[model samples]
Target: MSDVNVIPDMIADPSAFEDDAAFRLKAAQAAIRRECGWHVMPNTALSGVINTRGGSVIRLPARHVTSIESLTDRDGNKLAYAYDPETGLVESLSGGFPAGIAAIRYEIHAGYDDAPDVQSVLISAAKRAGMSPVGLVTSQSTNGSSASFDVVSLMQAEKDKLKPYRLGGLP
Candidate 1:
């Protein structure tokens, strides 16, 4: 996935970000991607490999796939397939994928062109990381005040918003 610096512009004051803000933002992006099981922003072509256990239907390791640039087997043989752009499901038209490690290689365009909810979640996470004192403060209390930070992970609300874009089954 490409490095997208959207958090800086999303913030009301870019200066509010600390010196480690870039790192924090990157970490936030990575965390979201990890949760989603794919790069969920900036639609682009990505090359990847998937192992299959002899199945006609193979789900790509991505979401919102716009197109498949190429799909080949281990022997570099192009395979005929049909795919759903929304769910990343590919149906083999010729035959089921052979069972093996790294049996399929593909280049595909996937992810969202404009996902405001995803961007919002990323910004929220980045801001939370920036405000943390030790970068690991899950919960803290001072005098009569108490606060908890999700830190590198998403809160339940954020996860709910991103559920549709998530890969595999359930978060």
Candidate 2:
């Protein structure tokens, strides 16, 4: 993890009035607005993680997203989400998002807990579903573990492609 600066949420010193709560709040709001504005637009490309219920969007570098898939209960069974290298962001969603996504893992997850190992599961699932996993890379995250690809792109891509979906449940 990168060093997280823990600045006091609010400065109390009156001498710091020029740098006081109101100014800081405005600055913070402006910064958030800028990022939120970016989220409202799509970039050339993007990548992120979606949870088991098909919710939870985690934005990371595009290169970090390792897989994607369209899920199905074809066998009259609920399938577990898996990672697919070929079904990576640029290739898979470039045409359009898969009908059902089991899960999307970022390069950062490699070697962490259930992550890196899930890469193989993703590949198998994609094959079973008749999709291909490509552009897969063994890399590290900003934290420097055996990470996978998160999403990568200009601000616009995520805004357009990923933002509208609700988190924590099916669409």
Candidate 3:
């Protein structure tokens, strides 16, 4: 993932801002993931643990789950489960999972293989960051030229595009 460039070629000239672009892209990706509450890009064989709510159905802390490599109880006993790959909803076939903190362990592949909407958000953020002058100047003027930097943030429309990927019922 580190070697992959999420920023599109049409967004900026890679040759001129190679290092800066990489840095900004990374920052933007992190911000997006933080906002969305999960990794929006594909991650294979990722291990995760979640507490059970004492039900047959449990929601994994992810979206677009592709596969489940393993599912186990707190005692390391293998558990049978059925899951919806798109919703991350897992149902235990071996009765309900016990209620406890981090009682379920799972290894799964989840998220989009390629999310263009997410990429667009990243590009927008990176571009905003790249254009702003360093430090905290909201507005600057020199030699009859002036510039104003709007704080870099996801627009409402961008946030709307990410809604489906967000966790914890946040809008």
Candidate 4:
């Protein structure tokens, strides 16, 4: 049916939402409100002439944050703007329990999904460290790419061995 002919029936049916100008406007407003509310957190609003008014609040959805936004005593300054769906990493802090003293020399290859034949080497390296070997980390880069790995279990191993040295102290 033509767009013009379908309008009357859409308007006639209350259950079905018609693809119309009014519906589009409502959808746009909803999108705006959703984005706006992402930045606001819920709290008790204290007000009124007698100073005896309080109510429940609605809090904002927390984004995957790694660290504090700012180092300030105030609440607002300490919070970061909600995270957007992008390439940010989510880091978790553990309570000082070391991860079995094992290290990884991760490798990635070009052929996507062809598991590399380095699992035995990883297990051997972990075994050399005197720790119970757990698992192996493997990855595949896009076409025309290549990678390598050589994990060792020396406690004082230099950071530059794994990645380009960021000159400061061992991380």
Task: Indicate which candidate wins on TM-score.
Answer: 1
Q: After superposition, how far is residue 33 of candidate 2 from its true place, in Å?
A: 3.7
TM-score of each: 0.76, 0.20, 0.73, 0.16
TM-score of 3: 0.73
Local accuracy of candidate 1 as per-residue lDDT tens digits, 58-158: 99888888888999998899999998665567899986877789999999988889999999999998888777766634444443244454457788998
The alpha-carbon deviation from the true structure for residue 138 of candidate 1, after best TM-score superposition, in angstroms, is 10
> Model 1's lDDT to the true fold?
0.79
**Which 10-residue span in candidate 4 carries the lowest summed lDDT?**
103-112
What local distance difference test score does each model get? 0.79, 0.31, 0.73, 0.25
Q: How many residue pairs clash in each candidate?
A: 0, 28, 0, 2
Best by lDDT: 1
How would you encode candidate 3's per-residue C-alpha lDDT over 1-171 as one tens digit per residue? 343433333323323534367777777787788889888896556797888777899888887778788889888889888887655678889878878998988888877888888889989987887776762234444432444434356768878888877975532
Candidate 4 per-residue lDDT, tens place, 1-171, comes to: 345433232133233533343443343333322432221112222111111111121111222222332221122222122322232221222221112211111111111122122222223334443332421112223331432212233222321222211111122
Candidate 3 Cα outliers beyond 4 Å, as residue runs: 1-19, 135-152, 168-171
Off by over 4 Å in 2: 1-9, 20-49, 55-103, 107-171
Q: What is the alpha-carbon RMSD of candidate 4 to the true structure?
A: 25.3
CA deviation > 4 Å runs, candidate 4:
1-15, 38-171
Error of 3 at 2 (Å): 36
> Between candidates 3 and 4, which one is better according to TM-score?
3
